[model samples]
Every structure is written in structure tokens, then in C-alpha cells.
Target: MRIGLLTDGGYPYATGESRLWCDRLVRGLPQHEFDLFALSRSADQEQRGWVRLPDRIGRVRTAPLWAPHEEDTRHPGRTRRPQGRIATGLGRAYGRRDRRRFTAHVTALVESVCAGPEAGPGPGEPDRAADLFTAGLYGLAELAQERGGLHTALRSEATVRIVESACRAPGTGRTVHSATVPDYLAFAAGLERALRPLSLDWYDDDALGAVDLCHAASGGAAALPGLLAKRFFGVPLLVTEHGVPLRAHYLAVPETPLSAPVRALLANFHGLLASEVYRQAALVTPGNTHVRRWQERFGADRDKLRTVYPGMEAERFAAVGEGEDGGGPGTLVWIGRIEPAKDLIALLHAFAEVRRDEPGARLRIFGAPVQGGEGETYLARCRALVAQLFPEEGTDAQAAGDHPVTFEEIGGAEVPDLAQAYAAGGVVVLSSVVEGFPISLVEAMFCGRATVSTDVGAVVEVVGGTGLVVPPRNPRALADACLALLRDPERRARLGAAARARALELFTVEQNLAAFRGIYLDLVGQAPARWTAPPDARHPAGRPRPFATPPEAHVLGDLIREPAVPGAARVPSWAVGAEGVCAGARGAGDGDA
Candidate 1:
């Protein structure tokens, strides 16, 4: 089976999120062909280049979200000649409309894009403004549809006017405020880039359309391409959102200089996109219930949602779990990116309280700062707080020195590997005030170490019945939990064993592969067949393909030729390349091209 793996600012990139897991997944399922559709978030990220690709990966198509591309075509002035009453009517009201009118127009505009331009709203028609909107929409859509993605021209003025008109129109939800001219222009450009999937060439006969399934590695912009793939083609979509992208955006952009109105507009835009992505997906997989709840709140169908924990490699920790416990009886260890969101301040205060109860207790913090301006400040703050908690560690002005609490990075000669870092402590800890999947805790579990973590994100869920969890921001409670674990070595050992068992059972690569394999068969069994060729005809040895879902497995019972569903449009019908393979994945697998 050919799989279209869509990602944004991740995967294939050596220094980005999701690169590891994506690489693991690609390597794990060697039988399936994979294509990478990636969006680079920065110039530096592009310069960093990609991780090496495996043989099964067919091709990679990338575009930049950080840079803008110049469109070759431009409109001389705002107005264009209209040929018909429809174009004229649309033009007059293009500035504003009632909710009903807005929906009708937006629906029509989207439909026009769906139908190949030859059958689209004609040139120079009365609704020329509307026609222009539709044309540009489809034109950009056509560009993405024909090429891979849009970058330069998506920021054009034509796109902005359309979004502006829609927002001001009568029926948009109250949340969508009328964007100012500048805000409108900025948002329109951003929206075009965000919605570039609408114009991607992935729907061609040789692309996503040929894939047996489209698996989105993460949600938000990463899933946009999958949404389009399902829309233009009947390709089934499997969306996996480990971390809620909407929430990430909310937390991340609050400090940006964007105006309130623009922020509100962007929020609504992502919300709507999430809703639509959830609504159209054949299956929605959230990494944990915390994220699942967010999906539910956003209108994802409960029946369609599933929880799939990310698989973490456990073999690396095997030796540590079997070796002598490196953690002192009362030691505490915190591992993760040194970001402010982790609430190192709270952890320091908690450790101070812990020290009061057990004078010998020590806290060791591991990990490096994230690559951002704020990270430096956060790191400095953490270092300062460490000095205050453990005075012997040195003063604020002192360079890092030996102390009760230590801040160290992995790959240091002393801590050569991650497992050794976990083994360095008797008790693992997670003090994050904000978190996603709690990967460090899982790693701790794999090392057979008991943990004390704040109740944030999926910490409690991942800890299950094994580790001690305390409410976030409560130093008293955290101190008490740490003290309890410290005083009871027997309890710690038992919990550590259970945690190791749990990690090995539910969070291993084998479990992830098995779950996805079953889901594939289930999805194919339910939907009517889209297109199929005899297995014998495709492979030389006629070795039965193990991954291809048989025609009878389509979940929708059978393919139904229904009119295009608005907002739920998928990949173009022609996206599947000849030989029933996605061109990118098939070609890329031979070796990176």
C-alpha cells in the first residue's frame, strides 16, 4: 500500500518535532510505500536539511511556510469586466452578504474549484468578482493540484479580498470579526498558505489518490493535506493528533505581536479547520484522552475517535533497568525540554519543601532549552532557581557547579545516553505545568523507575496506576508525593516494576504496528472499494501483498458516486499515479530523489 504521510515543520527534517517517530514508523512498516509531504517552518530548518530516508519511502515534496513566493500572474486593478448577471450580482454584494448568502457563495466557490476549470464558473461572467474569487481559489487549488504546494502566490491580494468579504458577510459566526484592511490582507495571505492544500497537486493520478490510505502524523496544518486528499479523491483518511495543534497554537501565539482581532480571526480559522478535519476523517486517533476531549469539544464524532499512544523504543533502557539503581534513595529527577511551560519555578519551590522534610533529598534536572529566544531566559531562570533551592550549587552569577540539584544535557560524557540519565536517579519526576504525551515519564517507566509528576496533559493517563501524580502548581502536594516515594523503597520498586511492564506492553513499536495494521483492515473492510487491481498482476513473484486492504473491507460498504460534499472535499481523482501507486512514495522508496 502506498501511504501519503503529511507533516508540517517535522519529519525528514533532522531538527524538528515528529522526525523521530515518523522515521521509526517508516522504518517499521517496510512493506508499505511512503511519500513525504512536508512544510518547513524556517529557513534554518531547511538549511538543516532532512534525515536520511529508508528504501520504502518513495518521494518527498516540501514547501516553506516561513517564506513567500511571488506569483507570476497579477491583476492590474481591482475591477474586471463581468459577462453575466451572476458575476455582476456577486460583485455588487461581494463586499457583504447575509449568512445564508455567504454559505451559498462559499459553497459555490468551493464547488467551482472542485470541478476542473473547463467546467468551472466561466471567465468574465457577471459574478466576475465572484468568478475571480472562484478562479483564484481554483487557480491556487489547481496550482497545488498540478504542482505540489503553493508558497509565493497564496499571499496575493485576490485571496485576501475573498476572505475579507466572507468574514464581513452576514452569516459568519460572531467569533469571526470584520478584519481591518491590513489584518484582512495579512490573514488572507496566511489563510492562503494554510489552505494551500486546497490547491496541491497531490490529487493527481500519481499521488495521494493512489494510496490505500492517507495517514496524518499529526493534526493542524499537518492534517490539511489529508483533508484535501479525502475531499478531492475518495481516499480514506486516518488522522492522528498526539498533541492538540489548536491548543499548541493558543499557548504559543499568546505572546506574539498579532492584534487581538487577527488572533481571534486566526483562532476561529484553526477551530473551523479542526472541526472540518474531524468531521471528514474516517478515523480520528488522539494520543490521549486529554486530546480526545479537545476533539470532542470541537465536534469530532465520538464513534470515529480512537486513542493511540505513541510507541517509544524500550530496548535502550533494558540494561539500565537491570543494572544497579543509580538514583540515591531520596533523589528526584526531572527530564524534558527546559521550557518555561514545564514550570521549573514550581518544581524548585517544591524541592525546597521536599528538602525541609528530607534534608538529604536532591533534585537533578536534565535536558536542554528549546531553540527559541524565550528558552534562553527560561533556562537562566531555572538555573537561578536551582541556586536558590540548592545554595551549594553556586550563586546566580556562578557558572554551573556541583550541588544538590544539577542541570545537565544528554550526550555529555557523563550521561552518554538517555537511559543512563534515568538510571542516575532513584525516582523519576515530571514537573511540567504544560505537557503533551509525557515522553520523559514513559522513558522513566521503561527504565523501571517510579515517577512523581504534576497532573498535566497526559501525565496521569500515562502514569496509570503506577506513578504518584500531584496537582500542578501545588508545591505542597508535589513535595508530599516525592517524600512518600522517597521514604518507601519497596513501594518504589513495586511501582517501577508495574510501570516497566506497562511501558513494554502498551507503548512499544510492536503494539503501534499491530494497532495500525488492524485499523487498516477495518477501514478497508467498511468502505466500498475505490479502485483495485489484481495482486498477481502487480508483483513479480505474485507474493500476496500483506498490507493492502481487500476490496471487501471498505467501511462505507461500497463506493457511492455522490456529488461533492462541501468542506469535506478530498484529494483529486487523478492524484493516483499510474500502476495504482502514489508517484512520490513509489519513487522516493527507490532512494531520495
Candidate 2:
């Protein structure tokens, strides 16, 4: 079975979140063929080039959400609709048929969003907002297929009018009802962007229509194509969200100026889209419980949710984990990208307290910030804060290496790469006030080092009480925890050993791959298989079944029919001590309904 793997702002691109995970997943599963459809977030991401793809990837298609829409070449002599030609010929223009359909669909969508899920009897469908949204979305998609594209149709004065009518519709929310003509225009523009996937030419039988399953890397615009594939081709969709895109939308500062009412309407629209995606998805995999809770609150079925922890390679730290030295006796190390959310300022203050108490203790900061210009500003501020917190040092106070707080990247003289960074510290400390998965904490665990991390995001869940936990932004508590580990070599050794054991047990690439492999097989098995196009003709197979028989009807041709005589067949792979492998309908860590 082939998979239509969909991703937004990541995968294939050299720079972005989850590229490594997507690369690993595709490479790990060789039995299934993958068709990658990636949406680049920026021109920079596109220019950076793609990661080298493997043989298992059957095809690759990409588009830029950041770029202007390319001209549609599907129809001959069909140029961009001329301006002021609205009354030319409802036939030559968006057919009177498709236009009416478009108006009905757009009306239903905006009304549902404005009136909210509590709105009664929406567009002759169920009271559920998801149903109403899906109905409207697919209706518009069908119209786009008949017409050239929705580039002009969605952004036209007609759409603006529909939005205004919906905003002022009966039972609408006060905020939506109070929208102005300009507000309607702003909202319509956003809808066009969000609904851009409908105008793409990738929904035919040669494209997503042929896939067995649509596996979305994340939700939001990334999953839009997958939703359409499921709607038009009956493909089962499996959506995996490392970070809930809906939450990201709500948290992100708007790039363009917009009114509060416009923001609220846009948020509601996205929420409705997310709910619809979840409603149609066969499974929803959340990276952590935090994201899973968000999905559940957004109406994702609890039974469909699977908690798949992001996998990391442990081989890089294996040698250091088993090395002779158990790291420095009086050092605490912090690793990961440097950003404001990391709260390096708090770590510097905490390290100052540890320096006063331990006297000889040192804090080595390792790893660069996330790619972009924000890192330089944040890094400079952190450096200044470090200087303010810790003054005089050995011999040369001007030299950064001589200071108690040494900031360095992954590659340095004493600490080269993540393994050496972990090896340079007896205890690993994470001071982030905001984090997604606390991957740095997991990396420390893999290196067989005791960790002291702030209680943020997935730290507590991933730590599972194997390491010391402290409150975020609390310098004294962080200092106390680091001091306890720094002073007691025996306790540090014990916790480090246990931490490494737990990491090996639950968070290895092998376990992660096994779980997903099972999920792929299960999803493929559940997806309905497609037969040949027409009953009268063959699908042009190398060895066609019979001229009379349909593709679905097949005899036992070369498949071995005889059962094993005694101990003839080898044990199935899943039955051979693969205790962590996901099996049957219930995968590993699938939440009970």
C-alpha cells in the first residue's frame, strides 16, 4: 500500500521542525511506498534545498504556501477572469450552477462559524459544526474542480458579501455580528488562503486519489489536502501532530494587521477545520499528553488518539554513557537551542547560587539557538545576563572560557557534540520556562546522566520521576536540586543509571519504529482496497487475472497453499520477543476509549 505523506512547514525542507522525524520515519519503513507532498513555509526553506531522499519514496510533490499562486494551465484559452465581467455570462464566468453552489457552501461555512457549534439546524445538516464545515468545504471544492480555480472566485466581491451576510445572520455571535465591510473583506481574504488547497490539481486518480492512506505530519493547512483526498477518494487519513497547530495559531502574533473580531472569526474557522479533520481521520497521534488533551478538547475521539513519543537516536551517546568518567564532579550542563523560552537568564542566576555554594562548580551551556535572526538577540542578552550574575574569575576575567558560566555550541574544544557536553557535567539542568517535549532532558537521560529539569511541557511526563524536578524560573530551587546532585556522587550515579535504564526501556528509535510500523500495517489493512477502473477492461497488469474476473476477485495463484507440517514455518516477527511492537487494532500507548 502506498501512503500520501503530507507535511506543512517541514519535511523535505532542510530547515524546519520535525524534518528529522519525518526523514527517520520514511527511511525506517521500507515495506510501504511513500508519496511526499510538502508545503514549504518560506522562500528560504525552499532555497535551502531538500534532504537526500531514500528509494522507498515513490514520488515527491511540493508547493509554497508563501509564494503567489501559479497560473492554472488546465484549461486552454482560459486567462484570469477579466475585471468588471461579473455580468458577462454566468456561464462563461463561474457558471451560474457553480456560483450558486459556491454561495451556498460559503454561506453555510461562515454562518456555522459565526453562530458557533451551538447554532441550531445549520445548512440542512446536523447541528454539529464539523458536519456543517465539511459539507461546505467539499461543496466549494467540487465547484473549484468545475471552474478553473477559486483564486478569483474566493477573493471576489461575491465572497465578501457572503461573509458580511453570515456575520449579520440570525443567532450570530455579537463579535461577528459587529463586523464592518472592511472586516468582512479581511476575513474573506483569510478564508481564501486557508482554502487554497481546493484550487490545487493534485486530487485526480493519478495523485492523492490512488493512495491507500493519507498520513498528515500535522494539522492546519498541511492536513487540508489529506482531508480532500479522504472526501473525494475515500482514503483513510492518519494525522500526527507533534504540536497542535490550532494552539500555535491561537498563540502566534498575527503577521498582518487585523481587528479583534477578525482574529476571533479566523480562530473559530480554524477550530472548525481542525474538528472536521479529526472527525474524518481514522487515527490521531499526538506527541504528548499536552497535545492530546488539546485534540480531545477540540472534539478528537479519545479512542483514535495514540501517544507516540518522538524518537531519538541513542547511539550518539552510547560511548559516553558507558565511558570511564561519570562526568565532572562539580559541573551542571544545559543543552538545547538558545531562545527566550529557554529562560537562560534564570539558569545563569541559578548557576551563580550554585557557584557560591559549591565554590568550584561550573555550568557549561551547549548548543546553538533555533535557526533565524531571533537567536542572535537572545544569545546576546543571555551573555550580558551571565556577565551581570557572575563577575570576577580565574586570571583573565575578560576571557569567556575562564568564567564559571561558559557558553559554547555543540562543537568546542572540551565539549564536542552532544555526547561530550553530557560527559562534561555530572548533572544536567534544564531551565526552560516553556518547552514542547524537553528533548534535551531525554538526551541527558540517554547519556546516563542525572537531570534537574523545570516542570514544563512534557518534562514531568517524560521524566516519569526518574530525575529531580524543579519549578520554572525559580533560581533557589534549581540551585538546591543541582547542589544535591553535585554534592552526592553516589546519588548521582544511582539516578544516572536508573535514568539511562528508563530511556533505553521507553524512548529508543527501535521502539518508536516498531510502534509506527505496526500502525502502518494496521491502517493499510483497514483501508478499503480499490479495484480496476472498468469491469470490461483489464488494468494492464503484467499477468492480468482473467479477462472475465474483476481485479478484486483473485484465485490463489502462486501463494503457498499448504500449511506448515510441524515446525516448518519460522516465528512471526512480532511474536519473536518484540514485546514493544504495536499489534492488532490497538497500537502501543493507544489511549483506551
Candidate 3:
């Protein structure tokens, strides 16, 4: 089965949030062919280039949401009617009642955009154009909600009138006043770009129509394509959101210059979009419970929700604690991106107390900053803290090393791979003030090292009794936990052993692959049969079905393929479909339903 994998600002892009996890999933599941449809956030990200994809990936298509093309392309030559051409056309499309509403709404929205501070909408006059846009947009959204979807002839005069009415409505924000004729035109252009999926060219049989399932690597605009796939081709969409895009938008919009009304409108738009995505998705897989809760709040069904932790390769840490030359018994290593969120200030303060108590303790801070410009500032501050804490740097330095607190990059001296960072210490420490499932802690467990982690995000869930837990920002508590682990060699060994066992059992690539393998079959099995196109729907790089004939339809061809022969073949009749080949319809209800 061909899988349409959609992602926004991730996967394929070199700089992205979940690129690594997406890459791992695709590589681990080689039996399935994947087509990547990615949306890059910025031109800088696109210029940085993508990770080299494996041969199993069939095709790649990308678009940039950060910077859309400036040139406006109208829908060919059409006669201009009253209320300026666009409004009349929209009016006719939306019918009499909706026609007036959509025109008024869109006009106000366009005016607000034209009036934007960047365009000349000044700070005093909130961009009413934005509000107008919101009114028109949501009006259309409400229409879609009422009618199941927008009609194909939606760009008529009625639509424009509905938009125009919304812009000129009373009690509306003042930003609408700043919207000039050109601003409205420009706003309309931007809206079209954002709503491009509504009129995408890929929904036909040649594209998503042939796929067995559409798996959105992440939601929001990345999933928009999948939404279109389901809408146009009847394909089932499986949306996987590791980090909720709506939450990110909430975090980001406050920093923008848009008026409160504009912000609220945009937020509502995103909220509505999220709800729609959840509604259309066959299943929603959130990487952790935090994300799962976010989905539920946005109205996703609990039954449709599944939490699948992103898997990591754990074999690299196989030699730790369980081996003869493992780490010394009293070191604590903090490994991960050196961002302020990692709370290095808190870690430094906690380490000071840990040092005073142990007298011979060492903390190895490994990892470079992931954020580009601001990272250097955080790194400098952390280094200064370390210098102040252990001012000298000899046996007066703290431990036996050149520096009691060493900050080194992975692939540098002392630390080579991530596994080596964990192995350098008997106890791994995480003093993050904020985090998302500390991947470093999981690596430490894989290395058979005990850990002391602050309670935040999925730290408690992931650690699962395998490590000591402490409150974030409490320096004394962190120190006490570290001291307890450092003082007990037996307890450390036991916890480390258990952590490794747990990691082996739950977090390995093998287990992740197994879970997804089952999920893929289960989801597709329950999905409605959507692929109704003829065999010509196949892509140029298609695979042939070797055993498409049913057992009842064939005599010589399937005679040898009947029941069970012996040994492994006789072990189970239900396991025959494990290879994803064409199976008989004796139990085809699973996929057909």
C-alpha cells in the first residue's frame, strides 16, 4: 500500500521539529512505500536543504508557507458585475442568503488587511481588514460546516457580496477602515494562498487517490493536503501530531503586531481548522499525553486517540553499566540541547550543592544549542555560572578532570556519540525547567544509567520509576536526589539495570516498528474502501500483486497455496497477511469495511 506522508515545517527539511522521528519511522517500515508532501516554514529552512532520503521513499513534493509568491493570478477573463467583479461572482456562488453575508464579510476582511500597519493601517486604527477577513473566513467555514463542504462553483459573485457585507458591518474593529482598495486585493490574494488546498490539483486519481491511506506526519497545514485527499479522493487520513500546531501558533501569535481582534480571529481560525482535522481523521496519534490532551480539548474523539511515543535507536548504549569498562560510580551527565528551557541556571545551582556534599562529584554537560542566534547567549551564561561555581579548575578543580564542570559538544573530546555521553556518568541528570519527553533521559536508560530528572512534560511518564524525580527549579531537592544516587552504588546499579530493561522492552526501534506495523494494518483494516479508480491509477513506480486471486477462484495457480503445509506454515492461518500481499476475501471484511 502506498502511504501519503504529509508534514509541515518538518521531515525532508534539514531544520525541523520532528524530522528525525519521521525519518526513523519511514526507514524502519520499509515494506510500505511512502510519498512525502512537505511544507517548509521558511526560505532559510528550504535553503538549508533536506536529509538524504532512502530508496524506499517514492516521491517528494514541497511548498513554502513562510513566503508565498507575490504575483496574483486571477481566474482567467470574466466580465465585471456590480459591487466590483469579485463580490458579484461570490454572491451567485453562495446563493441569495449566503451571497450577501460572504460579500460583506470578505470586503471588510480585505479592507482590514489593506489597512494593516505594514500597509498603512497605523497602530491607532486596528486592522479592521483582518476582522473582516475573519468574518468572511468563518462565515465560509460555517457554510462548509452546514453543507459538509463548499460547492465547486464557490468563487461566484455571491461569495464576494458575503465578504463585502462582513467588512462594513457595525461594532467591528477599526482596522477595517485602514483597508484601501489595493489592501483588499492583496488580502484576497493572501487568503487564496492559505486556502489553496481547497482547489488543489493533486486530489485526482494520479495523486492521493491511489494511496491505501494518507498518513499526515504532523497536523495543521501539513495535514491540509490529507484533508483535501480525503475530500477529493475519499482516502482515509491518519493524523499524527507530536506537537500540536495550534499550541505553537498560540505561543507565536502573541509576539506578532496584529491587533487583539486580529489575534483572536486568527486563533479561532486555527481552532476551527484543528477541530475539522480531528473530525476528518480516521485516527489521531499524539506522541505523548500532553499532546493527546490538547487534541481532546480541540474535540478529537477519545476512541480515535492513540499515544505512540517516538522510538529511538537504543543499541548504541548496550555497553553501559552492564559492561566491565562502564562509567565510574559517581558522575552525573546532563546531555541535550543547551537551551534556557533546559534550565542550565537551575542545573548549575543544584550542582553547586551536589559538589559541596559529594566533594568528588563531576557533571558533564554535553550538547550544542539547537536555536540559532539566542543559543550562544544561553551558552555564555551557563559557562559563566560554571566558572563562578568552581572558580579555580584543579583538584581544587572539583574532581580529577581539568575542569570540575565540563561543557563539551558531542563528537568532540570525551563525548563521541550520544551513548558515550550517558556512559561517562553513573547517574544522568536533567534539570530542565520545561521539556517534551526528555529524549536524553531515555538514552541514559538505554545506557543502563540511573537518572535524576525534574518533573515536567513527559519526564514522569517516560522515567516510570526508573529514575529519581525532583521538582523543577528547586535547587536543594535536585542536589539531594543526585546525592542519594551518588552515595548508593547498589541502588544506582539496580535502577540502571531496571531502566535498561524497561527501555529495551518499550522504547526500542523494534518495539516502535512493531506498534506502528499493527497500527497501520488496524487503521487501514477499519478504513472504508476509498480506492475506486482503475488500475491506471497506479504510479509509474508501482508494484505488482503476486497473489491477487482468491482461493475459490483459482485451481492450479492457488492449489499449492491452500491451507497449511507443515512447521511454520501450520503454526497459524491468520498470520498469512503479515507480508501485506493480496489475500483472499475469506476475511476481507477487515479491509473492505
Best by TM-score: 2
Between candidates 1 and 3, name the one with more favorable lDDT. Answer: 1
Cα displacement (angstroms), candidate 2, residue 320, comes to 1.0
**How do the residues 191-298 of candidate 1 rate in per-residue lDDT, one tens digit apiece?**
655665564445654676656678888787888777767766567788888899989988867797876656766665576567667877899989889999999987
Q: How many residue pairs clash in each candidate?
A: 62, 0, 50
Q: lDDT at 264 for candidate 3?
A: 47
Q: Model 3 lDDT vs. the true structure? A: 0.67
lDDT of each: 0.69, 0.76, 0.67
User: Of 1 and 2, which scores higher on TM-score?
Assistant: 2
Better of 1 and 2 by lDDT: 2
In terms of TM-score, how similar is model 2 to the real structure? Answer: 0.84
Error of 3 at 469 (Å): 1.6
Q: How many clashes would you count in candidate 2?
A: 0
Global CA lDDT computed for model 2 = 0.76
